[model samples]
Each structure stands twice: as C-alpha cells, then as structure tokens.
Target: MSNVTSGDRRVRRHLTAEIKSSLRDLRNQLSMLNRQVGIQLDLKDIDMDCLDLISRHGPLSPSTLARRAGLHPATVTGILDRLERAGWIARERDPADRRAVTVRALPDRGKEVYRLFSGMNSAMDSICADYDEEQLKLLADFLRKSTDAGLTATRDLSASGA
Candidate 1:
C-alpha cells in the first residue's frame, strides 16, 4: 500500500540518521563553548545560561526568568543578585505595578561577553557565506523548528515517568 520506493526510503533514513548525528555533535560543541565562556566570566554555568536568556528575551519578571531558565525562583534571585553586582543586569521596579520587579540586561556593560563570543560569531558568519539566501532561510527554518521541538520535549518530560 506504501507508495515510497525502497531506494527512496533508504536515502531518507540515511539522511535522517546523519542529521541526528550532526545535531548531537553541535549540541556537545556548543555546551563546551558555553562552559568556556562561563569560566572566563567567572560565573556559574546556570548563571551564564540565565543571563543569556535574559539578554535574548529582553526585560522579564524574576518569576518568568525562573521559568525560562528551568530554575527555582529562589535560585534565580541569587543569580540575579550576583549578576546585578557584576554589572550584567539591573533589577528595578515595574512602572505598571511597583509591587512587581523587572530584570533588564545591561548589554553595554557586557562588552567582554561580546568580545569573548566574537570568534565564534565570526566563524559562524564564515560558514554562512557558502549558503545562498534561500539555503540560509531553509537552514534557519530547520533550526527554529528543531528548537521548538526540543522545548516541547522538555515541557512534556515532566509528565513522563523516568
């Protein structure tokens, strides 16, 4: 009843396997790079991760930041305090409600982080040079979808019995 030819199925399976392997390699390499960056910044790995999320997501409440980082609110508080002291983030009152707090990334003071990541950024740019606009769009689409899938898996994992 299947319309797919055996040869076509074989090629698809091969490509799928290769994509999975490449994803694993990319994850490991990025993890190592993040660890190195954390070390250089003298920050805990989780703190670095939280700061990254804050920077990318712009202003966020402490609770929202905790959820995004998959950390406890108390733990995020400590991370925020440390980051605040380090001049990496600012914690302030929300204008809409004085009871609520907002956390903002102080990117101007994060020049060193940018400097440290410049090499990797340049390398990525060089790699992207080989791709045409359409290919780049396709690559971006794949990465975005893959990221969404990973996030979904993470959310669903809590319901699964280990």
Candidate 2:
C-alpha cells in the first residue's frame, strides 16, 4: 500500500536496532558512572540518586521522594537516615505545615557532589555546542519521549512483578 520497498524497511529495522543498542550502552555507562561517583562520595547508588533528586526538585517530603524515586516509603526512610547521617541532607520541619517534615540538601555536600560532575557537565556542554538550535530542540524532544517510555516500561514491569 505504501511506497516503501523491502530495502527501505530493512534499513529502518537496522537503524532501530542500532538506536536500541546505543541506548542500552548509554544506560549502562551512566549506571557505571553513578556507581563510581557513589563510591567516591562514600554513598550508595540510591543515596546518590536521592541527593540528585533533592538537588533538582529542592526540598521534598519523604512520601514525595519515595514516589519520585520509585521506592517504598520505609525504604526511603532508611535511605534518608543514611543520607542524614552522612551530613548530605537535613530534615526540617515544614514551615507552612507544622505537622509535616521535608528533606533539604546541605549546601557544602551538594557543592561537593556538583564538583564531582563538573567535568562531565562541561563535556556534555561542549558536545551540545556542536548542535544547532533546531537539532538541539529535536534531541531534547527525543530524550523526553525516551525517558517517558522508559518510565512506562519500568512501571509495567514492576506491576507484573518482574
């Protein structure tokens, strides 16, 4: 029905496979990078991720952190305990809600973590500079869609008890 030929389909399939492979490789590399950073910071993977989330989203309640991290509230409690013990974060009473508490990142600890990633951030910025505005916008869109798909797959797998 369409004008596409067998050769075109084959090419498309090959490109798709390559893209999948590249994405997997990237994910693995990022995991390894996180692991290395965690070790350097004397923190666990989840601990580092928690710090990142806090840094990005500002102060958050334990329940919100657990939801964002895809972790159980009790599990997040332990993680928060560890982070608090390590002096990376502090638990503060919410000013607007006296009954609630929120976690905030310690400035010095956050700065140290940011310093660890400064080189990588610089490199990524350099790479981005090579792309024009249109190309950068397209790349941003692709990344957003890919991230959403990944989150959906994670939810589906978790629901299936996989």
Candidate 3:
C-alpha cells in the first residue's frame, strides 16, 4: 500500500511538472513567433493586441475593440482609420444596429499580409512537419489550453487590480 501511494505521488508530480514546463515552453515559443509574425506581416507598428482581437473575434464594434485591446475608444478609432486608409480594413454599418459600425479585414489585403509572412510561417511549418498527425494535434490541443489558461489568468489578475 505504501509503495503504491509512493508511485502514485510520483506520477502525479511528474504530470504536473511536465504540464508546467510545457506551458512555459509554449509561452516562450509564442512570444518569439509573435515578434516574427509582427515583422513579417508588416504589423510592426500596428497595435498587435487590437489585431489579434479583431482576427480572432471577427469584425468588432469600435468600442468593443477598444475594450478588448485595452486602448481608448479614440485610439482604436484612429488605428482603424489608418488601417482603412491603407486598404487593409474597412468599416461598415452593422446590419443589426445601423448606428454601430463594424470594422472588417479585407480578404485581399489579408492574403497579401499572409504572403509577406509566408517564409517565416513556412519555416514553422517545416518544424511541424517532423511531427506525425497525432503529435501535431496534441501540440495544437496544448496550445489552445495554454491560451485559455493565460486569458483566464489575465482576467483574474485584472479583476484583482493587479
């Protein structure tokens, strides 16, 4: 019974440690990728948090985007103005709420942005090529979990006024 308990403890400890280490590794890797992606996509001067929120959540209200990006509404409007002028994005009245405007990514410009970063992205693809489909899926799963955890932690920290 004692031996079984000892073995169980070891297993639990190993699993926890592995998870912690993996999360750290993923965070570091993503930080590097974020830097590269910004440069490659010509988003270096663009506020990435805004771009990320817009990309993931689809077209957003200027106010919503500002809140999510942690920027003032005026700042978001200014950024949107620049993006619109650059032909990379557009703003149109929201169908459900004609008073509200939604900003959206133009597909052509989006493709161009992706094309610009294709080289670095290709390198990332090559790195993933060594992994089998199952391993790739597992890695993706971990990535999602890590992102969720980070978001949750951020929320909690903010709520606590940290």
- Could you tell me how far off, in angstroms, the CA of residue 38 lies in candidate 3 after the best superposition? 4.6
- For candidate 2, write residues 1-162 as lDDT tens digits: 499999999999999999999999999998998898899899999999988998789699999999989999999999999999999999999888899999999999888888888888999999999999999999999999999999999999889998
- Give per-residue CA lDDT, model 3, range 4-122, as digits (tens): 78779999999989989987897798678677766766564455556656767868888989877667798988888877777767789988889989887777766765675677789
- What's each prediction's TM-score? 0.93, 0.94, 0.71
How far does residue 116 in candidate 3 sit from its true spot (Å)? 2.7
Model 3: clashing residue pairs? none
Clash statistics: count for each candidate: 0, 0, 0
Name the weakest run of 10 consecutive residues (lDDT summed) in model 2: 110-119
**lDDT pick, better of 1 and 3:** 1
Query: In model 1, which regions exceed 4 Å deviation?
Result: 1-3
RMSD of each: 1.5, 1.2, 3.5
lDDT tens digits by residue: candidate 1, 1-162: 399999999999999999999999999998899899989989888888999998999699999999998778999999999999988999989888999999999978678889989999999999999999999999999999999999889878855844
Pitting candidate 2 against candidate 3, the one with the higher lDDT is: 2
Between candidates 1 and 2, which one is better according to TM-score? 2
What lDDT is obtained when candidate 1 is compared to the true structure?
0.91
lDDT accuracy of residue 153 in candidate 3: 89
Q: What is the C-alpha lDDT of each candidate?
A: 0.91, 0.92, 0.77
Against the true structure, whose TM-score is highest? Answer: 2
Candidate 3 structure, TM-score to reference: 0.71
